[model samples]
Target: MAKEIERKFLVSGQRWRTFADEGIAIRQAYIVAQDDRSLRVRIYGNGQARITLKVGHTALVRDEYEFEIDRDEAEDMLRHAIGNVIRKVRYKVPHEGHIWEVDVYEGVHRGLVIAEVELASIHDEPELPNWVGREVTGESQYSNQSMALGISEGARLHQLA
Candidate 1:
């Protein structure tokens, strides 16, 4: 099992785009989404796909298991997904010594841009880029699972930001 530890922040300006790579198109959905556990299927670009299972109650850390799956199967899973299928383009921006993944949401949750950096340990502090706005690390309302389930709520939060 892999421990997924990361911090999430809202993107502020367009400056980070300078350091970011050409983004990959991503479409993901949850087969099972709950407060402490979830099963998700994600398809990246037009070639790769994965199924992930995450279990934990803590906001910053989770036990995660991911496996490559057939793209056809992943698409079938998305058809049966419990909530909205999330559409986003993910860009990897290198800042300081860490790579921050910036997710620009599309479809129902348009105009939402969130940046996340994975940590090797809980104590590892990644420098925040100037383009990052408010930190939404532990906010459940900003979580992708929550956003998928509550489409209108996600749009409202983006407007408030």
Candidate 2:
């Protein structure tokens, strides 16, 4: 099984923009979303698509399987998804040998900005960028699945922690 270990943080300031490239627009929808499993399809800026299956209950690690899919098929799946489509622009920023993926949300999730870094192992400690704010790693309210399903209650646009 392929496992993913990552940490998520709320973006603090605009400093991250200086080190980021022009972001790619992303649209994702969840077909099945539960506490331990999620099935989702994502479409990228250039029309590339992928289907992903994630299983886990922890904040720091999860089992993730993702594969490329036909654009038409992904679109069809999105149409039948259970919740609102999650729209965001993803920027890749490299700092101190670690690449961070920053997601700036759009549509109903507007004003949300989050930064995430994947680690090689559960014990790995990555450098924290100054632009990174409160760590929301295990907070289900900040999870994409929860946000996509519009289940985040009082999820304000402010920096957490």
lDDT of each residue in 84-108, candidate 2, tens digit only: 8999999999988899999998887
Q: How accurate is candidate 2 locally (lDDT)?
A: 0.90
TM-scores, one per candidate: 0.95, 0.96
List per-candidate RMSD values in Å.
Answer: 1.6, 1.4
- Candidate 1 lDDT by residue in tens digits, 48-89: 999999999987999999999999999999999998999999
The TM-score that candidate 1 achieves is: 0.95
The alpha-carbon lDDT assigned to residue 88 of candidate 1 equals 96
Error of 1 at 53 (Å): 0.3
For model 1, what is the error of residue 6's alpha carbon versus the real structure, in angstroms, after optimal superposition? 0.3
